[model samples]
Target: MSNDDGSMKELVEFVAKALVDEVDRIEISEITGNQTNIIELKVAKEDIGKVIGRQGRTADAIRTILNCAAAKLNRRYILQIIDE
Candidate 1:
């Protein structure tokens, strides 16, 4: 992974941690590909709705920020929110 990857991961992690009641239960995994990157966000089961928000708007906002950042780096990003 490059420095940009690290920063992007940190960005997702930072945002996810802030949305969860159990910050310690939050986990993010990055799967790097040739053309696109997949960021998997996992938070406590009880906090899933909070992260996903009403009508998934919160998740969409996070994804929007990620895509904007990825565009500057000439990359593509995909966010997947999961319960853990």
Candidate 2:
């Protein structure tokens, strides 16, 4: 992965860790493709609600930020919040 790719991963990790109570339980995986990147975020089952927030607004906000950042890098980022 390129430095920009790693930075995007870290960006998701940092935000996810802050929202979930179990910071250590948060896991982020990145799948880089030619045109788009997928960021899979897993958090503790109990903390899933916290990360998602009501009406999914929180998640949407995170995606919005990610989209803006990815645009600057000329990439597309898809954030998938996985509960496990």
Candidate 3:
């Protein structure tokens, strides 16, 4: 993985872990492409709403941050939240 992918994974993992009760249950993985990196965040089922937040405001905020950070690296990132 490139530095951007690694950083994106860490960023999402950090944010999600902080919002959830089951920190140990948080899983973050990245799929990197030529132009985009997909960051998948899996969290405990009960914490999905917390990560997503009311009306998805939290999720949007995360995406926005990812976009800005990816821009600094001249890459693109997509964040996907998975419940387990």
Instruction: Give lDDT tens digits, candidate 2, residues 1-84.
Output: 779879999998989988888998988999888898999999999999998899999999999999999999999999999998
All candidates: CA RMSD in angstroms?
0.6, 0.6, 1.0
Poorest stretch of ten by lDDT in candidate 3: 1-10
lDDT of 1 at 61: 94
TM-score of each: 0.96, 0.96, 0.93
CA lDDT scores, all candidates in order: 0.92, 0.92, 0.88
Error of 1 at 24 (Å): 0.3
The segments of candidate 3 whose C-alpha lies over 4 angstroms from its true place after superposition are none
Candidate 1 lands at a TM-score of 0.96
Q: Which residue pairs show backbone clashes in model 3?
A: none
Estimate, for each residue in 1-84, the C-alpha lDDT of model 3 and write its tens digit: 656468778888878877899999998888878887788889999999999999999999999989998898889888999999
lDDT of 1 by residue, 1-84 (tens): 879888888999999888888999988899999999999988999999999999999999999999999999999999999997
Residue pairs in candidate 1 whose N, alpha carbon or C atoms collide under 3 angstroms: none
